[model samples]
Target: MSKTVVFIQGSPRENGNTRALAALVMETLAQSGVASAEIDATRLQCSHPGCIACGRCQEGPEFRCHVDDGLARAVATLPDYDAVVLSTPVFWLGPTAQAKMCVDRMASLVKCSDAGALATPLRGKILGLFATGATERDENLDILERQYRVMAEYLGMPFVSALFPFCGVPAGQAAADPEFATVARDFGVRLAGMLGGRKCCDP
Candidate 1:
């Protein structure tokens, strides 16, 4: 079966740098005969109220959130995909508010078993973080990467990579950088290869 990857774009601006990079990645994945889905978090009517510590998901064999919203839908669909790519623009040294909201809502994925041990539906999944920013400094990038790394660890997922193409401001600026496109495309190819059951050597 062909692998399916979901690309979630967290930038509120249409045609922003993050979206452009995500598009490039998706295009490359398509060329490799991999299925892809793009989810624009800003476009969704996601009023995620965060996790209320409700024990509903642990109440039955079927794990689910009581909230009826787009976030609930996202949590349900995320586990079905083989890999997930999160693309966002740096805002205040972290993911944009829209992206953070989605991430916060993901707490619902943590289901409690009858033994009361915590578990997440995201186990064994592959996750990649892609971001763009106006600064080329590592300070902001470090913050973003740390956050993503922690999130991946918490969900029991392997962080495939974190790609940051910097100096993107005023939107669409990164489009002029051919190097950024090359990097994004290469990252996509590698992710596609991994999805195809290829082992990646660490360098």
Candidate 2:
């Protein structure tokens, strides 16, 4: 069976450098015969006080967040996909608010039993991170990567790889960098191959 991937875009600017790289990745995945979907975090109807810790999802074996929003619907469908790609731009040395909101909403994946033991529905899933920043320095990127790594670990998911491209580039300029697109596409192809049980270079 062909592997399916969900690419979540966390940037508010639809045409930003992050989205450009994500688009290239998606295109390459499609060429490799891997089905892919894109979710725009900015468009989700998520609000503040995310994940109220209401213990609603813990009440049953089936995990589901009671929040009536797009994020709930998105999380409900994640188990159907083989892998997930998170694409975001660095904002103040971290992910954008939209991205963080989605991340917080993912708490629904964790099911706390009456005994207090925790289990996640996302266990063993493959996760990849793609991020961009306006600065050429890697400090911000390091912070972002660390955050993602921690999240993956908490969820018991494998942090396959991270693609950081188009750094220091202004909006709309990333598309002009042929090398950026080329590298992004290569990473995408490799990711798709990995999902299909064909090992390629490390992400």
Candidate 3:
């Protein structure tokens, strides 16, 4: 079976390092015969006020957000893919506000029960993070890594991550740096390996 991965872009800047790396990775993914899509967090942030915990989704006639906004609409389509990658440059060592809000609104896709939170539509799908930081210290990316790791485990999705978390480059430089480009392309190749596995494709 074929696979598709959706990358949620968290940078507001049109040509930042985050996008640069993502472009390389996406190119590799395309060459590897994997399909990909992207969602801009900057656009998605305006979609909803926030997840209100209205319980409407969990209590539902339909298991989804009742907000009737863009984020809600975008999240409803997540189950169609084989993988989800949260890609963003670090802001104070965490995701940008736009990205965080997009993630918050995704609560609509998960239903919490007495047993625990269940990411039914998203469960078993591959979850990944592509976090770039200007700092060379690999530790600078710990917060973003932990954030994605925790989310993946909680949602019961198999977790993977892109290389060069530090990236250690300025805005828009990832494309020019041959080393970073190699890392980024290899990340896509790695993701292809994960998504191509029979276990990942099983329903």
The predictions' CA RMSDs to the true structure, in order, are: 3.8, 3.3, 3.9
The residue pairs that clash in candidate 2, if any, are: none
Task: Give all TM-scores, in the order shown.
Answer: 0.86, 0.87, 0.88
Ranking of all predicted structures according to lDDT, beginning with the best and ending with the worst:
3, 2, 1
Best by TM-score: 3
Model 2, residue 32: distance off in Å is 1.3
Please list the residue runs of candidate 2 whose C-alpha ends up more than 4 Å from where it truly belongs after superposition. 47-49, 113-117, 197-203
Question: For each candidate, what is the lDDT?
Answer: 0.75, 0.76, 0.79
What are the per-residue Cα lDDT tens digits for candidate 2 across 1-203? 87888977888988788888788787778777777898888887754445777777767677778877777777677778888878888889888887777677777778766797769768888788888777754668777888789988878887755556336678756756888777688778778877773333434
True-vs-predicted CA distance for residue 104, candidate 2, Å:
0.6
- In candidate 2 the C-alpha lDDT for residue 97 amounts to 81
Model 3 misplaced regions, further than 4 Å: 45-47, 117-119, 163-170, 197-203
lDDT of 3 by residue, 1-203 (tens): 66899999988888898888899888878777788999887786354566777778878645467888888887777788999888888888777888787788788778877887464788999998887877754666776787789989988999988646556566798789988887788788889888773322334
Point out where model 1 deviates above 4 Å: 47-49, 52-55, 112-116, 197-203
